[model samples]
Target: MSAAPVIVIGSGLAGLMTALTLAPMPVVLVTAGRLGQAGSSPLAQGGVAAAIGVDDDTSLHLADTLAAGDGLCDAASAREIVGRGRDAIMALESHGVRFDRKPDGSYALGLEAAHSRHRIVHVDGDATGAGIVKALVAKVRETASITILEDCRALRLIKRDDRVVGVCLEGKGPVAARAVVLATGGAGGLYEATTTPLGNLGQGAALAGRVGARLADMEFVQFHPTALAVSAPRLPLISEAVRGEGAILINDRGERFMADQPGQELAPRDVVARAIAAEIDAGRKVYLDARAALGEGFVRRFPGIFALCQEHGIDPARMPIPVRPATHYHMGGIAADCDGRTNVPGLWAVGEAACTGLHGANRLASNSLLEAAVMGLNAGRAIASEMTAATVRLEPVSLPQMSDPAPVRAIVSRGLGILRHETGLRAAICALLPKAGHDDAAAVALAMAVAAFARCESRGSHARTDYPHKNASGTRKLFTMDEAFAFARELAASQPLSRTA
Candidate 1:
């Protein structure tokens, strides 16, 4: 709390880009884990999606994005992000990010699933996330206006008369600021096995709901169809680039299953993931075979995935790598405009935390980094453009204390996981409410429960067998805190009580 003009939560690509874009404006970056430990950005294998190739255009890129989003993408937002993709990539280059280049000295673009062209730009092949993060972190360190506070978790947002003024931290004290940008990433940790950092437990989305911000499409949790199937606590991801390079999805029977699908091995992630889930349920193991497709080039091109696969006793060049669907990204989050403005004034969200209508129902491959860079800069510019020197004094909002996290974790993992049903969801809501009592953890659980209950239809990542049909209209829904609470109460009243405090 050094009287900075802006307080940014999380230090991923979005947070770091936002802070850096607001150069010379005193800003403080607070991270839950070490700056780079809590985000999925650094774990990204495929690169950012941009219209950099001579044959590629924004319209084509937009079409690819909309197609991957399953007809729910906001056309305007998709066009805007796609149009700016090239510029965003160039901006990163200006910030000293070294991308991979071909022998001809131009960017070596790679293809990914659901994209019609070679638009994914990487660095060191599969280490795009690490490379981009490394550059941004270096830039942030040299900037005098940006102060880095590591291992500081945001407990709750501080509000006064519907305007966010600051946030309460777990370890560090409260940070008062003129503007707050949430870039805490996605809710992958809510699942038992996920590719995202273990600390990304949807706190940002929950905090926004508590502060009365509108949340959109919370049901669209995107599960990566090919995370390395291992017993590790945090499952590692085998990049989609492997498939992009011609790897085939096979079952334990040595059958190539993806060939039966529309896009084959390059289908939208949801389709691929659901197919894999079905195969697994049928007692067949899914594998990503890249031996014939990549040969020795696999090791050189994707050293990160190669090393990880090697550590797990699966040689990418020799054997078919075991894979499974794991919670990877959340397509829904706090509803924000293109500039990252939330319903609450002075509160902005970007990257995975903000639903900018870019991803729609499902996110396209490698488009995440592009969104982070573009939206981060947009949010940064928006905050800087509306700078105010008037310091508004505000009373602190009291948060209820919590002692245990086990019960909350269990509730989230069981009820609101990869698969959902009305019975379990209702039971989860009933069990979580009393245990939450009046604590902040309970407040978060309540939001999740409410969101899970509202999305009755099986769409995107939220698969509800009870409500199996996909909503035909594909209309995106946004919920305010009051709406969520009311729905939760209604659902709670209808269900029989299983537990009472």
Candidate 2:
């Protein structure tokens, strides 16, 4: 393995920030598409979470993050990440990111659910993600130390003995690197209904698994509550910022449903998602009534969403927008430390693909972007401080992609969607167990299904409808790819899993 140039996989905010942090040092970025075009970072609408206002403190932000995580958040990681919020934002600003500012020259911080203060730093009205990505992409293109490899998807890890040396890409030779960073985001694309790009089918997790990196909290998948229920395949998101601006969730009877719940319209995202799911399951149509909340200014405040609604023949200023729950985020991934180093040497992970325990059971609103920036920068700095330069040989290893992903995707959605039951998860395992290694997609799907089935308790984003109460053993679930597949095989050979938990 070479130890001179660092290699970053995935070109979302995390990857870009990491490469930018290690500027003046040679780095290579491998993306499945053009930079900032394929991943969920550019699709983020809500502003990044931070503790920048005078009324807000990092302690309060940490508390909200822990509360949302359902006791799964690591206290130290939460403190470290949330504690660095202001500096992260300032660092981005220095790189040409334009955030919304008040007339007094301070930031116009907006509020999202689960926060006690208005500390959501936004830009171009509701285009916080687009603004950050645009600036970073421009900065990367201008930098001479970074090499952008567009249209290259990393299919597998090139490991020697126990450590990852490089990656094998689709239709290409193995490229050696000193250190490899994974920022491939989430597995939401495995679901038929999701807000993330369709290509995010958990390939990164599978790659890490093949190299024996420990994956933790694989059961907690966070479903966003308010995807616009247009008949289209991929749903457009209705920003939670719209709800923060006073919009409310309502049912078919034109009643404010969230009024009866804690935090009302601004409850934790898990609670709100479940509430909406329950409404839809009960044959009631759910809608976001924003006409009375923002009126004429809705068009100006959210021009992108407003235009999306208009294209679908709905007017947000006059009518309630139909909404439903869709798989939005994965809180579990490659288990890594605060420095983004995985258990495997020379391999690191960050962003949604890394489970640092900062977001335990559920992520707080808009914290995804914050985690991306902070952890990406940390990974870059950590590797830069320790990398050793040396020459090495490159070896390409044959790895398998998922075979027949459609059936696996359907099973995962039915078994592991908003509300999960024992029967559905087991059946999903039985169907997916046979194709585990042949398809990375099926392997990742089986891993999540098995973890969800083994948890046998409800907590955070992982709600088990059968075991409807939280248990005292609030331990995190960890796994290896072989371990997960072995369990699935044994269980599949036995009698079917009973639903009488």
Winning model by TM-score: 2
**For residues 361-393, could you state the per-residue lDDT of candidate 1 as single tens digits?**
889998889999999889889899895743755
TM-score of each: 0.95, 0.97
Candidate 1's C-alpha runs over 4 A off are 1-4, 394-406, 435-449, 497-501
How do the residues 185-275 of candidate 2 rate in per-residue lDDT, one tens digit apiece?
8999889999888888887798899789989999999899999998776789998999999999999998888998889989988899999
Clashing pairs in 1: none
lDDT of 2 at 88: 85
Ten-residue stretch with the least lDDT total in model 2: 492-501
Candidate 2's TM-score reads 0.97
lDDT of 2: 0.88
- When summed lDDT is taken over every stretch of 10 residues in candidate 1, the lowest stretch is 435-444
Per-candidate local distance difference test = 0.84, 0.88
